[model samples]
Target: MTTSSNSPPLTPWGAAIITGVLLFLGYVGFDQFYLEWIFLLPLLWAIRDVRPRRAFLLGWVAGIVGHGGGFYWIIQMFQQFAGAPLPVGIVGLVLLAAANGVVLAVWAWGVSLLTRGRERHLVWIAPVLWTAIEKVWPEVFPNYLGASQYKVPHLTQIADFTGVLGVSFLVVYINATLYRILACRFEGKGVPWRAAAALGVTLVLVVAYGEFRIREVDGKVAAAQHLTVGLVQTNRGAADLHLSAGAIQQEHRDMSKALLAAKKADLVVWPEGVLSLGLPSREGTIPTWALGDLKVPLLFGACLQLNEEGETRFYNSALLADASGKILGTYDKTVLVPFGEYIPFGDVFPVLYAWSPYSSKFFSGKSVEPLKLGPHLLSVSICYEDIFPTHIRKLMRGGSEGRTPAVMFNLTNDSWYGNSTEPMEHLALASFRSIENRRSLVRVTNTGISAFVDPAGRITSRTGVWTREVLVDRVPLLEGTTVYGAFGDWIGWLCAVISLGAITLVTVSNRRDLTGKQNAL
Candidate 1:
């Protein structure tokens, strides 16, 4: 047992609330990332002696508060994207909480199931269970627990080998160790010296590895060739706004021209959907005058409308054009945002469209190829696609020379989220892709947070929200794949497999225990 069986149990509601607030502060309102290391301790301690059902309830409550507060911008998103009223937006937040909150619920239930009588094993069980749940459980926002440490580059450098889950594992392990030490003191039990030593040794190794990688990556950055690119933020509002296509295109044209006039760039990039035109099939369809007479190659986002099998489909895509305004190549976004981009099962149940009148009819892209411009093989992700590590990795691994994209580019329009924490959170999550792939990332967005991320996941030339700004920077054109890029989230997968096996064994053991008691009775 974790605590003395005779000791009185503490109420869990207060602990759950404390943990929930810590989670919110850690990831959302405050920038105190240190809270992430201890956010789960309160919840873990509260649930140590509780039954699985009560444990799940406490965990779900904490998750609901955490996710609801962190994603409060979802209310504004519903208002802007779906034209929902304030009450509907509130409902959306509640629904989001209830849905994504299951991650914590299952995690708590799994912990209670595995360590019912052996609660002392929480130091060993909690980290793997949390990691596994995070890996398998789907989230609309894919906000990994490790992303909170993005600001602490030293702690985040290990992402190259183990992905973000590595950092999460470390955070949970620390919390568990600290909780165990505290629990022992409360119960008047012997100190857990082994757990403390293991934690100290783990921290030492992680810090050493982080320092070594930072030095190595910094050296590589200094020695690598650089690409001068111009990033343009148009400050346009949501896609459904009163802004006309002509106005949008003209803003991009003006910005691109101003950037080129001020400084020379190998390429100038525009935010997603700035062009607002169907990509022309034949050359010369996009007149030279349409590109603002810029002499350099332009990489911009546009809609690719195709008619195949007697059906018309629209795709969110990025297109490359040379100085002469001739089409070079195109990359379609393979991942589509549900409800925001297209309604799931809307075709079979057409009435679903009535509920979400503002949703788009865009189809998912079929390709993940990068557009080529001279020596630069630019891997492009449209909108929120950059938020998914696996998708970005696959895009990097695309082409005959697999995982050889020299640079990563993301064309996003974050106007749907308004001026909220969503843009910053989005930027934070997307930064990991740079470290995971060991490649420079240039993110251009409509209505702000446009910046350049180095191979080390450091942000440069960051622009604020709702601003019309032009940022010109020399970003490194990095090659070669890191361990994470080559192998993907192996650690997450291993933890998931372990969690599954543990669940199986626990179920069988519970059944046998019940059967033995029944036979003796």
Candidate 2:
């Protein structure tokens, strides 16, 4: 790609800083999502005339600042959850931001390599590389560029077909097109109206499709049966100095009783790990007092310990109980949080556990199964498991009966991050599960952002942070699955394959060119 002799007089570092800060603003507090559409312009323009190595460095610079700012809460998270000191927490955040930076660095390098001879293809090439790299790159907290647009329902409805990465693809596509237009003007060339027109048409079609789908999904939700669910948020710390296990349990029971007194509810849910004592995994072992006077079915997070022939196993689980306190079913959390729940490779290197003394050692659940409450089958996710789209799809896909989930439930404890944007961000990502599977999601968290999201990805009701709230809503029980629930991130997988092919071709071409030059020499 060619740069103008009279282009904007900004240095590469200046451009990187602008892109990075804009990206930070687009995702976090004061979320100006529109900035996401144009944030990449500066970096893309700066890298147009640079070598691949320089482009990669520029990309890393922008990524470090952007990711660092967006994920600043990591410091507090480590401090609270891991009990790490300030210096250690700061170092952890730096390492995290640097690691995430590598994804963008690869994208910039790939774009520079691909556009060596073909400059005009930047519009498509950049977006494809960006989407592909972001898809394949693994992170501690998995998120996509599309998540920034979570509040914008019209732009997010396409997730039912292609998942969140599809939304990321479209956002980058717009950025690349805008960059192309601006680059043309800088070089004193004619504006690429055809490219602009293509972008406009694509957006129009996307919005139009979103409009149609929203209306259709809303109709489906209206026609479906509704379940009155009560969500209890206790506003207690993850490990409070004052509250005892019995006291915490009492708080939930009191709130639940108030809900029953006001209106009837089919189910009442509590956040993850509220019950500190490990309940033995045996029939007739569930404490009757746990249910108290409420006659309704109750589901709450607890630790279950099973003693087999000669060993003991601990599970982070959600146990469902009948009106008389009979244990009906249990859905153990399948996707355990790294470090928070269990150390990665801790068993192999036992010393790692010694180094981080607070890390948990719980085992992952065996399968994804929905707990049945009467006739309605409830798909359950504990804590951050709801953030994973494919995992949720598997749970909602049904167990042996081949019947989809009537309603989805996520029991989470957000007290780990305190009063930060983490809860809000978590809510944003979890809301898509309802849209993809066309089920109402009832999320109950310990320290706020407890919400009810409908099939249209609309936040029906939500509670404030650090507040004790008893949210009662008639959550719709949906029946059908969308393309995403059935197929599972097919678009992202396709993009990854394309990216691998492109990287292979580029490497082969570079090697052939080097061989020819050596022969000439």
Candidate 3:
């Protein structure tokens, strides 16, 4: 790790910095241009000639740079939207980005140790190790690099069986292959034509498979049901959302009236946290009757409290009601938002609560069961839950049992990001979930991008942003499961195993070569 005087020096530390910048640029560039993927190359490059500790540090730096740059708008979400002060909001964003970066840093450290002297082969090992890390790392900032691929339908077809992990694996592997070819050419070493060829073949296969799946799913027309769905978009900003108790209740009432007047739809949906006033099940709390007159089974989001064994538990929940405004069944949000809903390791980080929006502790749901509504079985996804592909598959499969459920419902409030690309990005991810599970998704949003996506990831209908509008559309209730829904995330697991096995083989071969060299000396 030294440099020349005549030419610009490339120290290990300098390489680390370059790695971070390149990774950040790659992510930002890909996201802005929709270039499928390019971020994985920098991870391989960063650890190409580094020790384990340095590799870990480089990876961490790269992760922070990439996430911090890509999701910087999240700070606006915390400050202008969630009503936090500017300094605290910036710190929260940095903490989140760094925390996510730690996962990649660990992966780099592990791979560097395994391939100490065999840096040239990092192009093969780093991607697989990183993919495995991303797949198994329990929901600490669950939205990773590949999660952004939800919008690229052609590439996301692989998610059917592998979930999002499969897409991550493929993207990293492609980047690794490209890096290998370039490195070989740069050093005057013979080009790794095999790596280049393999990459080309894999791309073709992915594209071909995606094309086939698209055609197959598109050809089968869903028998359009006559059921009319009314989607309510509140268009309320974060400041408006956190108004006084009386004002909050009044807002819910006005939104309810707008939804009720929209049409005589069979089912009406509301965004997440529309009724943040209080839980309806709690004592002295305003009931659903106070909101508006309902004519059908209304599925709306609210904070609810349930008593179990004389103890009251509060939840961010979605409740279903009949035409007479009688409560039917309630679905508590199963996958809770990390810092937003409940802080992780709250025992250790007591001060974190001061920055959160909730005044009290939030309880997570015990199950991912679908609520029964007349003849239809509905699976519910609250806010960020829609981004997790496996969660949706499990919900649909668990709910469907042996028969196909009527539809999937998502209740979300994207007002956190205000008027940015976040809302559109969120909608794009939801579309992939719909396609992957072969189900129609009905999304009701607080701010904008409320719409209906059919089984093939096509937006059948949508609403304008920052507008108080109710959209009624006839959506098809899909029957039968896709290959992804049936098999779950086994494909991703298999890819991960293969990746690990490759790393093991490379490490063993390199170790043997080192031993032979020492003996000869």
List the candidates' TM-scores in order. Answer: 0.96, 0.95, 0.83
Between which residue pairs do clashes occur in model 1? 397-403
Candidate 3's TM-score? 0.83
Q: Across residues 1-521, which tens digit of lDDT does each residue of candidate 3 receive?
A: 11112223344445555555555444422454233255555456557656777778877876787667756767877665445788978997798789887776877787777766565665667566767778666654465455556556777787666666677778777767776776677667878877778888888998898888778767655444546788777677655765754565566566656766756678888888766434436233234565566656778888776676678777888877777777677777888766666778764888877756553467877666677777777888898888887778878875535555668899998887767667766777677777778777999887888999877677788998788777888766656777778877675566568766766776798789899999999
Residue lDDT tens for model 1, 218-295: 898898888899998888876633458787778888888888888999999998876655533523446777777788
User: Weakest 10 consecutive residues, lDDT, candidate 1?
Assistant: 1-10
lDDT on C-alpha atoms for all candidate structures:
0.84, 0.84, 0.70
Q: With candidate 2 superimposed using the best TM-score fit, by how many Å does residue 356's alpha carbon deviate from the native?
A: 2.3
lDDT of 3 at 253: 61
Please state the error at residue 516 of candidate 2 in Å: 2.9
| For every candidate, C-alpha RMSD to the true structure in Å | 2.1, 2.1, 4.3
After aligning candidate 1 to the native by TM-score, how far in Å is the CA of 287 from where it should be? Answer: 1.6
The pairs that clash in candidate 2 are: none
In candidate 2, residue 17 scores what lDDT?
77
What is the Cα-based lDDT of residue 351 in candidate 1?
Answer: 91
Q: How many residue pairs clash in each candidate?
A: 1, 0, 0
Candidate achieving higher lDDT, 2 or 3: 2
